[model samples]
Target: MSFLLTSCSTYPVEVTSADQLAGVWEDFAGRTVEFKGDGTFTATGMDEADVGEECSGVAATQQGALSLSGTYADVTFDGVDCEGMMLAFYGSPSSFVVCFTRDVTAGGCTGELSRKDDVTATGRHE
Candidate 1:
């Protein structure tokens, strides 16, 4: 008797987008993420080791929207119903330049919009 084994993959294999902002953006730690035209993205191999920080290494599917206005492409993810906004600066020779902002509040887990927010950090595309 003969037996065979196979594996399944959910990652996108062929990603073609005319939009300049569509492509793989690898952060400082090496998480090669791809933002599809359909407003969905998947990033595997994302862990604290790759992030070089304290974080739960759990894979998840996130939906978002991408908007291009003048010189910036505003991308927002709805994993947490407003995780934050990843602002991508256009017209750059570099691979990518993005900054993220989170909705923080004094009352933890209240899910209320805070009056003030801060930029978490900026990352580049790989």
Candidate 2:
């Protein structure tokens, strides 16, 4: 007799640079960010536990390469001023993660984004 088995593997890649990363990327936590490919991005629904409550829905347009090792941008709403950084967390490659400099939370990093893309029947994106 013989038996057959199946398996799948997940090898997520890290976003090393902020180049060519365009399109509307949505996280499992309902946060969304639209990268315009010009070092300026527009986002909405960013006031989550992972994301910063200080700023949301309004992002500042800056001129320069927004990289993990370079200049960060402002994502303040209603003319508010707060520095926000976008990068793949050193621990892992996180999607749509926005690290703020003024977040009251520890480390000031947003942990809402997820890699799970399937929407289950329970209405949960997990």
**Which one wins on TM-score?**
2
Clashing pairs in 1: none
List where candidate 1 sits over 4 angstroms from the true fold: 1-18, 45-59, 90-95, 102-126
Model 1: lowest-lDDT 10 consecutive positions: 110-119
Clashes of 1: 0
| lDDT tens digits, residue span 8-97, model 1 | 111112212325445565444444556566655555444333322222222333344656543334454444333334333322332223
Could you tell me how far off, in angstroms, the CA of residue 34 lies in candidate 2 after the best superposition? 1.4
Q: Which ten residues in a row have the lowest lDDT in candidate 2?
A: 1-10
User: Using alpha carbons, what is the TM-score of model 1?
Assistant: 0.41
